[model samples]
Target: MFVDLLIGGIFAMSLLPLTTGYCAYSYGRSFWLWFALGVFLPIVSYFILFALILRQQLDHGQRLLTEAKAILAEAEEAERVQREER
Candidate 1:
């Protein structure tokens, strides 16, 4: 059972080349670049793809902060306009 699962997992990993190709295409990058790398280095290519998808913790927090500030600013402006019209 374990060996079967392992084999299946490896087979799924082998298909990363296709996923990488599609991702490259969607991102307007060179599909052949990742495709060839994945074909030649399946394990390394998996890590490469993983790295590409990683988001920095700081960046995520910063984006949330920026969005929150924008929302707050808009609400404040609406409140100020209501006060001025009265």
Candidate 2:
């Protein structure tokens, strides 16, 4: 009975890190690093992963904003040229 309980406990402990590694892999991140982090520092690893995802989103938003500003500037320049011609 004691041996069975020990095996079950080990399985339970390993499951979380495995799941975390899989999540990192699915997100195109480093699987082994997350797995090790999850094993040693589960909560911290999750926070770090979330922060990375948020940073990527922020970068994408900044790129889109820059593109929009450039397009608007081009449109304004064209309008100004049209006014001069008139």
TM-score of every model? Answer: 0.43, 0.59
Compute the lDDT for candidate 2: 0.84
Residue pairs of candidate 2 with colliding backbone atoms: none
- What is the C-alpha lDDT profile of model 2 across 19-52, one tens digit per residue? 8788888767889989999899877887888787
Question: What root-mean-square deviation over C-alphas does model 2 reach?
Answer: 11.9
**Of the candidates shown, which would achieve the greatest TM-score relative to the real structure?**
2
> In angstroms, how far off is 6's CA in candidate 1?
20
Off by over 4 Å in 2: 61-86
- The weakest ten consecutive residues by lDDT in model 2 span 54-63
